[model samples]
Target chain A: MNDEIVLFDYWRSSASYRVRIALESLGLPYRRISVDLLAGEQRAPEHRARNPQGLVPALMIDGQTLTQSLAIIEYLSETRPQARFLPADALGRQRVRTLSCAIAMEIHAVCNTGVINHVLEITGGGEEVRVGWMKKFIGDGLAAVEALLDNPATGTFCHGQAPTMADFCLVPQVYNAERWGVDIADLSRVRRIAETCRALPAFQAARPETVKPA
Target chain B: MNDEIVLFDYWRSSASYRVRIALESLGLPYRRISVDLLAGEQRAPEHRARNPQGLVPALMIDGQTLTQSLAIIEYLSETRPQARFLPADALGRQRVRTLSCAIAMEIHAVCNTGVINHVLEITGGGEEVRVGWMKKFIGDGLAAVEALLDNPATGTFCHGQAPTMADFCLVPQVYNAERWGVDIADLSRVRRIAETCRALPAFQAARPETVKPA
Candidate 1:
């Protein structure tokens, strides 16, 4: 049985970056296929066959293909205990999931390329509007995340002392935040968490600059 | 041990709608607290204290407060197997999560009230633009979901014959598609699955009209 893991991803995509961090963290060797978001390769027939959603970071593992970065991370967490993507306790898991979804669902989803492009088309707005949109949502969203982290459970990472799925999400989102120049100086907890995650070799290797196409 | 469940939600919020369906499906009795999104009550200090994200559908259960609708649903799915919100197998769970995230993260998040309102504000467009935005994203998103349903794994529901978290997400999204008048007549699989789920009392009871405050 051929069980080689393949990740179809875009380097700059927050979702794709998340799964890369997961795979790198888990020490899972996988093939990387860039679905160039720049050229709209994700909408190609070949990519569509890989993912009906026509989104990147579709992970082929365990003889099955998985879409949705969070779901892929959760699958990795469930199957591989080497790195715990989610916490063991229900409440802890819920907290991590909540934090991850805050970024994925609330921030990243809205800032998605398809979405922002539509926003540009509808509003007749240009690059400036795109930057503004990113800053507003990312800034406000991270502020809320900072508030959510105001808990005794929050350790060095988004959850406990060890990193979890929440940190994986946070790093990519923070990258987007920095990319769009969304100020996080006020978001102390988010800044601190991103710094901690970025220092890790797993997150560093998955960086957009690290995998940016030549 | 205060196990009494409480759900802080707005009637029209899609995320809240997903949680409502989950509770109804689980036959889990919960106290409903309305955080009026229209009046901007969700931004109130009290609600923010409960949910730092200031989002609707915050669930209080098993002596802890949980936010993020899908996380709440997943928590319920994990805690209570009587309803089986997710599949038992890993691959099955991945598919269900992917489908659920498609709507929850991809469609619903982008079409959120905050995002839409911001669009309106920035575009200087009126209600017509809002309608256009809703139709465009909801229509395209559902179409992708329809393509995803083409899989053999899709039975009467989004996954197999039994309803999982995907169905919970689908019901609300379909309702939004209908509410926004995004035509789904061409989406046979989605329409059929929605019809099948709608026929079930759990989904019916969670309809926005069913729980809408007078």
Candidate 2:
């Protein structure tokens, strides 16, 4: 049986980046297929066929195509228990899932391209407005995340000593926060965690700059 | 043992509504404490103490405070096998999670109050613009979700004969969609699923009007 895994991804998409981090951190080898979100490739019928949502980071593994970044991560965690993407206890797992969703569902979802473009369309705003929108949401959202991190469960990473799904979600979002020029100096825990995540080779290989199409 | 379960929620909140349906469907009784989102009560330090994210539907269950509607539902599913909020198989669970996140993370999250309010702040637009923004994002996001429903796996509910977390997420968003006047006449599958779900007491009892404070 062929075990080749393929990931349909865009270079800079947070969702796509999330899947990449999961794959890399799990030490899984996969082929990357670029779905150029910038050029409207994702909206094409072909890409939509891959993911009905027309979103990137659709993963093909174990003869099934998986959509949703968090779901994909969960699948990996469930299948590869050795990866330990989730904690062993139910409560710890809940905390990791909560922290992950706080960013993925709340912070990253609002700042998506479609919503930002709509803001530009309705407001007749320019690049500055777009950047402002990103900064406002990312900064405030990260503040809430920082508040969430002040818990006994939080360790060197968002959940515990080892990087779990929450860290994968966090690294991409922190990268995005920096990309939009949102100040994170006040978010001490967030900054420290992101810095710790960046030092890892797994996260380093999944960096947008490292994975961007040459 | 004080087995009393408490749910801190706001009526008309999509996230809170999702949790209410889950608890009701599972036959788990819980007390409701209103967090008036309109009054900015969610931002209060007390509420934030319950959920650092300061979001509605911070559930106090099993003597622990659980935040994030989807995560709470997952916790319930994990602790209660008979409830089956998720599927049994790995792939089925992945699909269910994908469908659930497609709405919760993509649609409901983007149309959240914080995001829409920011849209208003930037556009200098008022009621009409607010409604327009709601209609546009909710409309487009649901259409994508409708397209996603075209799958062999979909049955009476989002996954199989019984409702899963996907249905819980779908019903609330449809309620929000109708509330905002986003026409769904063409989304037959979504309409049919939501209609089927609404007829069930679990979903009907969780409706905003049903639980709205007098």
Share of native interface contacts present in candidate 2: 0.89
What global local distance difference test value does model 1 have?
A: 0.91
- For residues B32-74, what per-residue lDDT tens digits would candidate 1 score against the true structure? 9999999999999999989998889888898888999988988
- Runs in model 2 lying further than 4 Å from the true structure: none
lDDT, model 2, position B58: 97
Cand. 2 Cα-lDDT: 0.91
* Model 1 chain A, TM-score vs. native: 0.98
What lDDT does candidate 1 reach at residue A67?
94
Per-residue accuracy of model 2 over A1-214 as CA lDDT, tens digit each: 5689999999999999888988998889999999987898989998888898888889989988889999999999999867889999989989999999999988998898877888889889899999998888899889999999998889999988999999999999999998889999999999999999999999999988998889
List TM-score (chain A only) for every prediction. Answer: 0.98, 0.98
**Clashing residue pairs in candidate 1 (N, C-alpha, C atoms within 3 angstroms):** none
> TM-score of every model?
0.98, 0.98
Q: Model 1 chain B, poorest ten-residue lDDT window?
A: B74-83
Error of 1 at B156 (Å): 1.1
DockQ of each: 0.86, 0.88
